[model samples]
Target: MEPDIATQNDSGQDSESGLSLRWSARLSLTTRILVVNVLAIALLAGGLFYLNNYRDRLTEERLTQARLQLTIVADALSSGDIANRDALVEQFASHLGARLRLYAPDGRKVIDSFELAEPTYQFVDPDAEPLRKDAARMLDKTIESVVFTTQIPNFSEPANDVAGAWSELETAERKSAAVSSVSYAPDRTPVIVAGKSLPDGAGSILLTANARDITRIVRAERASVLLVILVAATISILLSLFLARTIVRPIRKLAVAAVRVRMGRSDEIAIPRMPGRRDEIGQLSRALSDMSAALRHRIDATEAFAADVSHEIKNPLASLRSALEGLERVDDPDLQKQLLDVANDDVRRIDRLINDISDASRVDAELARAKFEPIDIGKMLEQLLAAREQRTSNLGVHIAFARPAKDVAKVMGDGGRLERVFGNLLDNAVSFSPEGGLVEILATPDGDEIVIHIADQGPGVAPDQREQVFQRFHSDRPDGEAFGKHSGLGLAIAKTIVEGHQGEIRILDRDGGESGACFEIRLPKAL
Candidate 1:
């Protein structure tokens, strides 16, 4: 039976030779890694999006501030009345705290605040003052040329240069309009350019301010966000690998161990018992180990049972064969009857042995599936003793029982199996007791457990043979008993049932150095 089970279980697995692997099954590890990185990158993308939007808002805000100043200067220059035009416009530009310039309708440079304030500048007025020596050469390699815009050299050299030269001032007499644009100077400084045509198209006003501060802040912020995202993504990948190693490795180990156990490599192969871990994987490892041990135990027991059954059945078969052979040869009728009687006894013995063996084989399975409940050992014992008294009334031996205190004898187990166990013990005791012997039964609570003692006034078991009495087919019945009266499986089955409930049973020394056997059963009390 054990070999059959092993073969049946492994045959299906071995036959799966074709490796028709599906993507989901084969790519679990890859899936884990991809999932982790995808989530991390998504967060990074969100942060970048936010930074881009923030940069746009800041740029617009700076442009709006420049526009406000440009509008103020344009309105002041276009006022209805004026006196000392150059001085008044210079006062307005100064008060507004911006670099301001005015152009006439013919595109001629009008009032220039930079020229007025810094007359010493070599290129303050391009027509009035000769261009600076370096500016006049228009070289691609000069301090001011490299850092500030070379175009519009009449204005103060800016801190940064735009990417390329700006569009020329074509169509000067085109239309009255206000326009705004952004540019970087040769020094990489951002500049906001605003121009507004004055009321009635009298002239145009232009304003230029360094927007380097805000642009620098935005670039720095972008770099910092990218750096943070890079570091986080790297760390997340490493951590994800560590997590996969911790989880996937143990599971694979368990799978390997199971295959080894199933393939008959060894029964007690070491299983990794990651006891320190309290996670789900840890729990899974432990469960697998436990299941392996249980299956091995069951297989061993099944094989042992098969061997024992074969050995036990052979004896009756041999006797029957001898009786049949004798009956065929015997001449006298009495001798034939004796041989016939011998055959009958052997047949009955074989029947009894087979029945008992069948029950013993199924006991384990039944107990495993049995639902348990709280039972009052005292009440069960009362009923058992009554039944025994009625059955053995005509016999010489009498049975007696002592009830336990209320609630003291309660235990958790299958009531029917527990009853069968005590019944077997009582029957065994009665069979050995002398005529009119008292078979005493007692139940009581012993701390967290309930203890039941069944003592009979019969020959006590030897200390050495006490354990052997509970073994299968261990028949050590007393003399004068009818042949085939007992199958010697009762005590074995009783012990099995007791253990199924996580309880214990043992032969105990009789009180007062008595000449009788005492069986003690202990069970955990029901909560």
Candidate 2:
């Protein structure tokens, strides 16, 4: 028979399904959390590293400026080309925009820029910008902003007035060292000071540059950086929310749907479709929805099976009841024997119906959990034909076995179940065959599959009833066959077992459209 497309595709589908299941199982909760948070953590770490290096550069630039000023002044002090030391000191301090102090070894100040510069200065108060003309005139004599230089000229104990500056210069002179430091002056101005000892004990030259400019620039840049960081954080938060909605929320919904399916409410649960999205989550959602639909279909099929079982069992029960009632009333000895026989037959028929019904009901679940092993199809069919031929010897019917090639019909499935499947098919073929007719069982390799054919020389099945023959309790036994001899479950059970093994089974017209039914089964070859 030609293979059914669904059955033929099952092997490939199973392999793909297994891979997907393995990947889903590997993604635990912790792994998912790490995947979601890694980007944000990396961004924060990179920003921090960049800011740290930038601050270091800023600090080094400020220090380098101070060092350069100190070196120039120290070099001038040791130079013999200058005729006026005071003029040279003044020129250096003005050009560099710094405070320069030259102290002799005894702590005597030779030249001080603070002492030389004019004391008077004008300052504007921003708070007085809107004052009236009369108000401004009245406050002209008042000390609005300008202040005089506090450095006293030629004062004794100059070391006490500018202690930090004096201490650095004295340390440089005594130790013949060079020093660079950042500190605050007495007036609270930020200062970058560098002092180096002059050559030949010419005293120490101390250069102090106001660090306010660099400090203010750094503070402004830091403020700007903080603003940028805040903006970036806001954007990241928005993007994270969008990602969470797309990924995390859908996954959570799928989780909930799975839980509902497990709780036996799959039919009641509705999974949202995300067909447009081409992402991992979208694939997962689609898979979950398919699983739910399959589960619902199984549930519906199970319910129908139960209903059919009830209807089938009630028939023999009603016959047994009627036979028993008739036996209780009949008086003639022959009539009583006939009634007893009918009751006995009805009891056996009921028993057969119950057993077959039980087996059919458990077929789906059993096959789902059935473990499979490789079995040689040719050998299995040979053994089955031998058993059937032995049993049916007196009936003058025989099941004959044939193989296309020796040792080439190996297939993967439950060996016992496969044996049962062929056993049923051969039994049905033998029952349908004429007296002394041969029922042929043939196994052949068909590409990746092993195909088995069971042919009989009986009246063939009609085209319209071909599909209905495998339905539960649906039968078309020959005229001479005894009533209640068949439960009509053999073909149905065989079909289920073949499908469970990822194989296909079908009824085929015998060669040249002659009389008789031919059952064909196709099973995947063992690797």
Candidate 3:
């Protein structure tokens, strides 16, 4: 079978139809922002944590070294040289100011700085407990394997106004109250706790370190890390905002194009395909191009058909006016009767011609949206037979509705149009049917489709001419082929009206059905 002309429909529909321009999924602006921010923050946090950890370790090593240096110096002073002990400590403290703390064995002070008279020190003995001081606190109770120290600045003895305070210094070995904090507080002497042992007048010594420098370095490093993150965040936020704008702009264009397509203004879309983008936008552009090409083809065909319709209808209208002019001058009784009848026939023919042109033009529309109401094929055929009997009684023709459902054989179709469709079928059957011959109407349901077979027992159409009879202006009448007798459009009109309701009406084999020209109509019950 030849393909039917494709239909184009406006977007009017019921609530069941879910046609629109919007596409919704989990993707949104908020989601995009959240993803970007989370990733940025995680990376920044990781890098900052790593560097802060390293700086803290470095500060601990430096403080440890300084405390070891103090031990070395005190050993030298106790061994023999006390003359330059103060000068030596002053030099060490000044050079290693950031990690300096000073104390003697039994927790006595030779010099103090940073409000640390006697500060606690960390031990790594595994069994060592915290020693409280009124100054720096120990973060780890066990002594570390190595000592690290940066020397504190030089110190001067308090003047006469503080002579009593100075005389009270280091008189007894006493631990201070709880140490408050540990930091890089400048101008502080190194904190040192030494254990002096005398075995047969020979000397032994032990040493410990403070945590002030490690704590201070961590604070400084954390601050610097925060600054870096703030700068990175600002740049990321600006870049993300720009990226979001770029992404959303193309999406908006695609949205408008989709809306135009849904609105039947398919020709209006010219999607803006950005250069070098091979993502979703490129795919969408290709799709829209295909849609536009399809629409343009339909628009061109419709224009051409409109032209053909205008040209075809003009001839009949002119002929109709000429016949009316000729009938106006008739005067004799019998001649007037003949002319009036011919004129009336011309008017009817013109009406039929107009209706045919209109119906053919609307074949697509009807196929696209025609509502199928319940109709009885048998009852409709009965009505057709009863009406055509008056015209056929003189010709000795009998037309019958042959069926399985009998009078209740129902089909779904537009009733009035189906009436016209079958009326034409019966007329064609009777025209080619022999006198005293039978025209049969047969129907059977085939799946979701209904097949109706209309056949006659007269001379069947030739194989070559079977399909030709349905074209516009073709005819099968023997000789009543007057100007308006069979305008060669009856079968064409029948075909148009049938297919318009989403049905296939074709001329099938006559002999295959036991005789004559067999025309079959196959219609979907509903789609």
Candidate 4:
């Protein structure tokens, strides 16, 4: 019916659109990656910040518990606790979750439950230590000025009533001995020491709090915080991927639209839009549509104008030819001859115009339907040479054909068209050659094509004009000049015919064989 391809093909092909999308996607990748990474980084940072705050609060709560435990041991050891200093220190160590040591009034260790060393935690010797004053100041920071005894009555009051029963012991050691009840070992675990005077002033009381458990819990809490940060980073990566795709989809559509517009198949391109988010792509789509519409309109107008001009010119030529035929039938001899010449000139000019129009119109068809067949190029040239030599022998020009090897110079062409092309070349050579000069036809094979050189011993064309000599209405000789009635379309028509046969025709250098103009035609061998 209408047309098979018209029914089959899409309004715009996907190949062009797909290529544009691929390039646009590549161009956008840098910005897309940046945006995705930025969002992912932001999410990671937020998660890390939350985890840090949570760990900070938890550690603070644990430290607060440590502080309260420190206070109970301090209050208990500061008062005289029991008759046996060792028994009292042991009891205080259990309650305070610490190590204990009791020092006598002379600073000798009287009872030691927790082992003490010099480097990490040193026993406070009020007399020998150079840092005793600073150490006492440090002690004050750990101890409360007044005891809020209600929080841990079990350890605080029992140890306090025991020290109260040893009032005589308090006199020698002073409150310092009871304070020395808390001491240090090699490691830095805060040891609560309850130091007291034994009822007979034998020893002091000490109690200590070990800090290793609290340290382990702190490290574990930090690890938990890092785990939360890793989880947050993973979530952020996923979210960023989603956002990047959403933003890139519309851009991809715009890319496809541009390709469709460039292809000139359809002006209709639909762009996805958000009502309130009319952005750059929306403006671009509108602009492209307008341009496409304008181009289509201009092309239609041009075609119509060409058809009208062709029609108008054809009508005048027809009328002019009819008038010339009427003039040929007149009785006046002189006027008839003059009118005939002018009419002939008009006819030739009209023919050139018609040929130009025909060539321009059929260019598409010629290229598409061009096919080649085997042609004996040397045989064809020799035959033409024989025919022309007999006919033009009276013109004083010699026709020569170079015999080529049988299969070496085989050509492929339209036989009739090739004959006309050589005829035009022969006619041109005959008109231009000097008296007794040679016109030669030589055939040689060149790769996939056969080269035929037709050389005439005539004045070669000017360098600049050699190429234009094949254009319709282009002539080197003037009207009624040396060459008789040069229509100027012979070479033009020859060139078209040769090209329609998928061959090339050109002017070649004429040096070795003869100093003349050489016209070369190259045609492919038939498959």
Candidate 5:
């Protein structure tokens, strides 16, 4: 057997709810906020990678300077006596802060600056450095690896410290021009070397410099940039979380409250209305709270209406049942006829009650969807009076309308509903008026509103019962009038329709101190 319809509907709803949950869970608002904030810091941190190029340029400039100095020294030695070359090399090495070496045409070590004078510079051994320096080296190595993707060969002395072991010197001799190369020291500092061929093929001069300042400057700049990025990232994350809390928390609360309302647990839920906030979220909260209150009111009113309908309907049903039972036992023709009349009246009352209840139940919905247009209250009342005169011989009760000036009593409303309102009031006035009594209608413009008054020469309603007369099934008819002739919903429905049209209706005493009830209606004038 197929599954029950309710079970199928439940499963369908569950699947849809699960799909929504999964979709929303994929990326939370907080994560999205964090990512958007952090992305800016990441872009700023990209400057760290550019330091590699900066260091390379610094090393290349230092190597160029070394090459120029070596060429000058070799030129000076080539022009001078060979005996003074060692002293000149020692002097140049001391002045330039570098190590100088002279090579023969056959790659033999001719003159060495270290042998003639004290050493100019030496490389620091990284393994013997302090922890802080080790960390600096690690950072330098990491940056180089990330940017260049390849390691620079470590700088080292030639085997046996001979001239032939220097590759740049051979390259300069072969090319007959200055050449340079660079490598990294053990401490992650740059070591630059340049070579120049001696004039007239005498030999070649090789100069080596430990350009540690280049690495120091690049690492210093990188550290500063990283520090800025770290601070900015921290601030961005904190602010993102703050924004999410302010935005997402309220929305989550609304969602939870809405879910409770949808689950029929609204009586236990109090939707928060953030009155202090002036933002869109605050507006949304207030709107939702108001909507929830309206929904609750509608539900309570519907329950009350159902109960009232049951009570009202039961009375007529009971009377009809009693009359039918009496007709079954009564043998006399007069008694049977009387019972039949009673049964017919009860049936008519039941029919009228059902019709009024149906109309009352749907009035709100129909008015909500009704399209309103400008209607002239004067013309409408005049036409209503004419039609009533034609349809019913008012038993000597006369209706006189003091129509307003042209365009003075125009209002925006559904014409049919407005006509029904006037028609109900007119019929009520006629029913209560004595024979030959006058019913008067007057329409006039009062500021932005069009006011209409229907006054009847009848026993006026008591102050205590004026409000009660508009309630459903309230039948305080005039003396000698048949009971159940009116469903008592006429005034209630009139009040509902007037309120729907953004108007008001109230009972009042006639202005002239005459003993009659005056029903005043006020409707907003059409612009």
Candidate 6:
């Protein structure tokens, strides 16, 4: 047989949920929380990488400025006499914070800034630096490695220390314009070198500057950013752990309790309701606790039902056995016939008991899956009373239904089950009423509910027995009624169906000082 639509949908969901869900299921809640928090700080840490590009842009700007300054200085010297060129070069060197050199057209060294003036800057030897400076340089190299910054040649003076050894000057002479290049000193500081050809080919001038301040500024900025990121990351991790503790711990406890319940140890496990918390988690806790309690109640009810069924079946079986045994020992034809009738009645009673038990057992499951529609309580009662008047053999007992207006007592319920509920109640009232007595059924709307009362003018039930009458296999029939004529499950099934519909049913003393039992049923309105 083909599976129902609900079963098919459940199977499809279980199979079609794909790899991402499966993979995520393997990670604990704690790991997911940590990953989410850490990823944010990692994005913030990316700023350190951009600092490398910032340093490069600053170096390029410095190189362009130096080349322009050198070209202007060379032009000044080219327009003056050769006797004053050395003094002019020295003046430019001191002002620009660079070492300046003037060379001849044949690439011969003419004047050197250091020979004429005190040196303005010197290259730093990394090995002779303090520990703090060493740490700073290490950090610079680490950042360069991480960002894959382009390699620059290390700055070194050639053995000849002349114009022929300087590549920038050769390029400047050939191009007859300013040219510049960058290199790194021993301490990983930038070295900017700019050379320009003098006006009318007087010579090429070279200016070299140790741009240590640029490296210092970039490193300091990087350190500050790194410190902030470290602090933020530490706080993020701690908070993530704290959040995991608060969330995962309670969920874990709930999971363990559910497992125990599933293992049939519900008697020993008490699922926490977490009443102090007012969040979704607390709601889940209370919901699960209530569900477990309901399950336990259901289990107990099933056990009691089985016991009652066994006891009820045994009495009829024993009577059947005794009648059959007595028939074998008797010889009189009338006695044998009487025994045969008793055996037939006991067999019928057993069949009736089995059918009633089956119906009682199925009431809950059927109502759970039943689809409810809007039913006018007054109209249903009118039709029911008409049908009963036609078929009912109890002509001496009259049933009067005080039906309300159309649509006034509308309710949402399974029509067939509701019909059965009222049918059972009406039959019960008819069986209890005296000859020429009245059985009254009244349906009316009371605000948000449809109220129904089935009262009979018969020996009323004692106040103490009202609750017991709704329990399974509880038969308290009227005196002189045939034994086993009613299985006693009708009222119990009625109560179960009413409760399943989110309604209520109760037995009360008849109003207006009447001597009868009143069965009152209240169902929610359709709207």
In candidate 1, residue 469 scores what lDDT?
Answer: 97
What does candidate 5's lDDT look like per residue over 1-527, in tens digits?
44222222545655455445454456878887898789988888889887778777787788888778877887888898888888889888999988888888777888888889988877888788899898887777787777764567889887776667888977887788889888888787878889888887777788888887887798789889989999999999999999999998988888878777767754767689999999999999999999998888889888888888999889989999999999889899999999899999999999999999999988899999999999988888888778878888466898888988888899999999999899889878988899999998889899999989999999989999888888777788889989888888999899999999999999999887998999999999999
lDDT sort, best first? 6, 5, 1, 2, 4, 3
Cα lDDT, model 1, residue 178: 49
Cα lDDT, all candidates: 0.73, 0.71, 0.58, 0.58, 0.86, 0.88
lDDT of 1 by residue, 201-265 (tens): 67666666666566457557756876888888878777777877887777778777777777787
Q: What TM-score does prediction 5 earn?
A: 0.85
- Candidate 2 has a TM-score of 0.75
Candidate 2 per-residue lDDT, tens place, 1-527, comes to 43222312545555455445455455755455555555665565454335434544665677677776787778766784546777777778777777787777665667677677632212233354554533422322121122222221221224454424466665666666666666543322246667777887666677767654553454456456557777766776666667767677777778776766666644678566589878888888888788778878778878977888788778888887888898889899999898888888888988898888888888888888888888988777767667765676326776667665666999888888888898787778777889989787788888999888888998878889988888778888988889888888988898888988989998999988778999889999989
Tens digit of per-residue lDDT, candidate 3, span 279-358: 87677766776666666656766786566566666776676677677767866778767766766776777777677767
**True-structure lDDT of candidate 4:** 0.58
Report the number of the highest-TM-score candidate: 6
TM-score of 6: 0.92
Go through the candidates in order and give the C-alpha RMSD of each one to the true structure. Answer: 9.7, 10.8, 13.2, 17.1, 4.5, 3.8
| Pairs clashing within candidate 6 | none
- What lDDT tens digits, residue by residue, belong to model 6 across residues 207-260? 999998899889888889999999999999999999888899999888878777
40: Cα error in model 3, Å? 8.6
Model 2 Cα shift for residue 356 (angstroms): 1.7
Which clashing pairs does model 5 show?
none
Model 1 earns a TM-score of: 0.75
- Residue 360 displacement in candidate 3 (angstroms): 3.5
Error of 5 at 110 (Å): 3.1
Superposed model 2: Cα runs more than 4 Å off: 1-68, 71-75, 78-83, 103-110, 118-165, 184-190, 196-205, 216-235, 259-279, 398-400
Candidates 4 and 6 compared by lDDT, better number: 6
